[model samples]
Target: MKYTPVQYKVNATILIKSEKSGMLSELSAFEDLSIVKNNNKEVENEIEILKSRPLFKNVVKKLNLNYQYFAKTKFSKRLVELYDNTPIKIIFKEDSLIVDPFANFIISIHSKNDFTITEEGYDSIKNGVFGQVISTRIGSLIINPNPDYLDSFIENEIFLSIKPVMDIVEDYKSRVSIGLVHQDANVISLSLNTTVKAKAKDILNGLVEEYNIDAANDKNQIYENTASFIKERLSIINTELSDIEQGVEVFKTSHNLTNVTSETELFLERSSENKKGVLETNTQLGLVDFMNEYLKENKESLLPVNLGFSEESIIRIIAQYNETALRRDEVLKSTTLKNPIVIRLNEKLQSLKLSLKQSLDNQKKTLKIKLKDLQRQDSVMNAKIASLPKKERELRDIVRQQEIKETLYLYLLQKREETAISLAATVSSAKVIEKAYSSKNPIKPKKRIVLLAAFMAAFLIPIMILFFKDLLDVKIKDKKEIQKKLDIPIVAEIPNTNTKGNFIIAKDDRSIVAEAFRIFESNLKFLLSESNNQTKTILVTSSITGEGKSFISANLSIILADPDKKVALLGLDLRSPKILEYLNLESAKGITNYVSDKNLNLEDIIINLDNIPNLDIINSGIIPPNPIDILKSKRLQELFVKLKSQYDYIIIDTPPINLVADPLLLADYVDLCIYVVRLGYSDRELLSVPENLYKNKRFSNISILLNDVNINSKKYYGSPYGYGYSKPKSWWKF
Candidate 1:
């Protein structure tokens, strides 16, 4: 099919210049246009993109064209165009032009703190930068009928949408390239190409007028907005200042604290006087205490010597008493106690002592009298200090608040003046360096560049999609999936083995695979503690087949029998029997034979392994017709009861619960039910099946076991279960 080529014949160029700016406006808008954001929904020049997309849509509608078809044709390179065709170009001070419509443009505006230009600021300058060119819409096209149109443009109607009679081309915003006039100039040049010269001239004239008017209006709006914001802040500050002043006045009146400083000085003076009185009283009390203590010793004659007495009369009396005492001691050393001279000296010494004691008691009475007076004075002064006024504290607090509010009010008034000055000094961020003019030659149809881009995208898209598709797989890759999806406890994790046989446990080698079975056995004992006192019957099943349930059961039986306990491995999967094949035992006479023939005893169907000590196996005799019915037999319960008395541990391997009713039917006969889930193989959604069964009490003791886990995986690096006890990897080869 052949279609008319869409190309522009007329071309026009317009210049947007920033007047006194650091080129912040031009740079920011340029960045927004150049940068392509998340999913192409967001752009750097948000304001221009928003206005341009809608403006172009309106233009296409008026011209009566299909927007979807037109956009698709240009994007896919279905309609070939020229290489020299450019859209809008934003030039910086260095003549740097931003012409890429698919890049994210960012402009750095440095302030004391870096100033980030917001989306709103970008919106305001869009029209000033792009100018007011009329938009056309595809719906108005004569060839296509639009249901959204209010009324069709009939032959007699206004005929608002007319097909270009002069073969005029509809140029898109992307095709109208922008560039710099010179390399080292801040001159931005916008160019659009069309098919008609008159249309291009009219569009350029409209753009010049629109750019100037829009730029001037945007500058005025910014001034008005800034003034309004400052005025609002000033009003709030004034209201708060008034409220604070009122509060200060109310507090002063309530507390009766007018002169805060003077009252505080007066109270402080009273406190000082009280402190002096207390000091004097304490001194007097200390003297009285010393005198009382001296009297207690009954050494009144030596009072002047011990206490450093200054009174002359007391000193004279003490000297007389000491003289008499010395004379009596000298006579008593030479004569008998009945001698007249010694007796006379003793009587004199007694006389002096009585006189000294009376004088000293009189001195003590005088000191006690003085101490009581001082104590009374101290008490009165302390009471006065304690009662010092609280009005001073309350008044000081009120005055501090008043001072703060007054300071803030003055600051706000100063800020308001500065804001008013700023409002008056408002200027536009945009400056039109040149008026819009049309070019002599047409510019459109960048055919070569468009074709190259299409080719690159065609080569890379499929490869990228395929790479990401693999990363989005939802299959369970580890034990984390089972843990995240289910609420049940994970009892154990068995590592994936490269052993040749199904029963991967080795008794001779202490490898990781052998140790994993031992860990499973220990976890089983904990799970079976309540129900498995003598012979614990553990039923192992899974969400689906091929989850390693039988492998776990066989190894676990071997580990249990290692402790010199009687262990029995029972194969209860009637639909598919693989335990016998793994054990290389005859499955022709086992559980099925015992169930069919009631007369058969437990020993008739049981197979004891000659190589393993105390280990026995009861394989599924044959694939039964009715597996669920066979599981529900009374003989099966009787057989388990007999096995419980005979063996210490019984491990029962059952069919997958999701596939058959056999496991759920035999769940009652077992002490514990172990649900096996394979890592990296099973679906994450299937874990809910085991969780539901555990919740509804279908199995009394139910726990999940993770199988086929990578031992080197991160699961062992964390948590409550360290699981780091596995043997070395070298043992597997040996």
Candidate 2:
């Protein structure tokens, strides 16, 4: 959520700050070379170190961040971080608290030292005092009073909590954002969300301080390691120098050694050059030996490259090896050796190591040949200066080696001093341009934005529900809706009238119901196309019984029969008949009686009504046990053939097509099928049944009729077609 939840809100939550950090790219002669160059990567790396888990865990441990203390002030409901002003201290074992990371409870301070837990546990700790350890449902804990706030907050509540430390660490990690002050610049901008002003300052400042300490320590670590190596070597070399000096002293004392005589001075001078060469060769050889030993001992560590090796190429190769090793170490800090960057650095280091050892081998071999040549020259010079005693010559040899060891020892001493300088001058990665500060208001759950969002949701919810309700409604709503769903052409949309009687059509009637039937009569000419040589046998059926197919049929018969057109209203819906009920006739003799007996004819079942002169009603007669069997009889077809010659239009009302096959059996006799669908009553799903019948050509033609559309409803009827006449004065006048 853009507006995060407020439950995790703390005091002084929004912190915005910036600082300039001096990220050390490389330490050359203890110089901070990063200031002049664009070391953007080092700046990013320092920021990462600031947020590292190890560093964050140090902060957590220092501040005891896992246990949070909060209390309300006298003026506000907002809980502020008690921080150093906590009334009571909570003591718990980390191991026990880890079992339930969210052990949130309250301590009610009745007095300075006395308190009780508002939320008790199974242990249900009794009232305890300051410094008293009591067992609770969460774990064993103690409440210690603050000497400063003890008198200030009595009969007051302190809300204490132990949040899961690891999760909180991650939450802060995500919450604290780092940005560059400008592109390719060393300065960094840091922002963090926290509630307490002091806590915010501490977190931001603590992070920068720890980062500086860590960076400084890392820089010094290399120099310290180098210093340690030089010290160890100096000790061994010092001991060697002492032993050689002692041997020289003993040899000279035993020989009573003297200086050169006049004749042997030139010989001694010539020999001195060879002795100096031997000393220089020995020193280089000793350094090579140390290098070989170092390579053999350390499989994965930095080598001391600044050790004064006579071979310049050897020093350069070792520098490359050490640099690669340092890179590998940096990679290892964030990930394991399985990382590809670490693996590649490992491979490069191995190659450099091989090159370093080869260089040492070639230099050591050259030094040995030079030393052997120097010894041969010295032997020749000694023969020329034969007057000198042999004991004196032996004493000089001892003294020469002692000088070499002393020189090497002094050289390591100088290197150690340089390393100490580097350690002392290790620079901090960051310089605080400005200490961390906070915003005037909190960042999340902005009141104005949240109020706007809530207002929008409140207004939109009801409208969306109503829109979906209308979209997915299963019942047929109106004529246009049915037209959109089905392929059948709607012949007429009949409006339901206010009259209580079923029959509405009359001579010169101008009611909306009568007008709707007149429109249906006119549409029949287009529907009854194949009725040129025969009566138009129209079958009125519906998907279900309550769709007003029978009511529409009787009204259509009266409208069609205008003295020029003879219309027969046949009641063929033998099961659950409604035509006789609508017309108010007591004639029991109907189609069923005529169809079963040969003595009864079609004329016996059909009755003429005086109100509608040309219209005749053929009732359902007696309810039959076998309506389907009666409709299937040969007499039914013969009856239809006889009626086609006498009547110009035959309106036959059959049983609902969805309920029985009686309508389907008469499919051969009917010219057109009027499928009646009642608006708001008929199910939209039933339109598919009629569609399937039309597709299979079960009826020659099927026209749709929407019945019972409310005349006054603008949504469905959309303005009735005619102005209706007033109700009759007496009920039966019309």
Candidate number achieving the greatest TM-score relative to the actual structure: 2
Instruction: Give me the runs in candidate 2 sitting further than 4 Å from their true place.
Output: 1-53, 63-65, 68-89, 93-132, 137-139, 143-219, 251-278, 296-302, 320-353, 373-395, 429-546, 551-570, 575-652, 656-705, 710-734
Compared with the true structure, all predictions reach lDDT values of: 0.57, 0.76
TM-score against native, each model: 0.37, 0.65
Most lDDT-accurate candidate:
2
TM-score of 2: 0.65
lDDT tens digits, residues 439-531, model 2?
666666677888898899898988899889888888898777777877888899787775676765678878777787888888988778656
For model 1, residues 1-734, the per-residue Cα lDDT tens digits are 12435445443333333322423333444343221111111112222422243334444434323211111132453433211121112222212322211211221222222212112223321112122221112111112222232122121111111233122223444555545566555444555565444444444444444444443443444335434543554576568668777877887778765554554466547655544444443333433344345446544223222122334455566556554554454345436789997778777767766666566566656655665675576556545545556665555445545554455455445544544443444433234454445554334445566678788888888877877865676557876667677788888887778567665465764666666677777777777776636778788999888899888888888878865689999999888887888777765688988898888888888888878878988978867788777788898888888888889888999889998888888867777888988887777778778988988989888888888878676766422234354445576663
In model 2, state the lDDT of residue 442: 63
Deviation of model 2 at 609, angstroms: 14
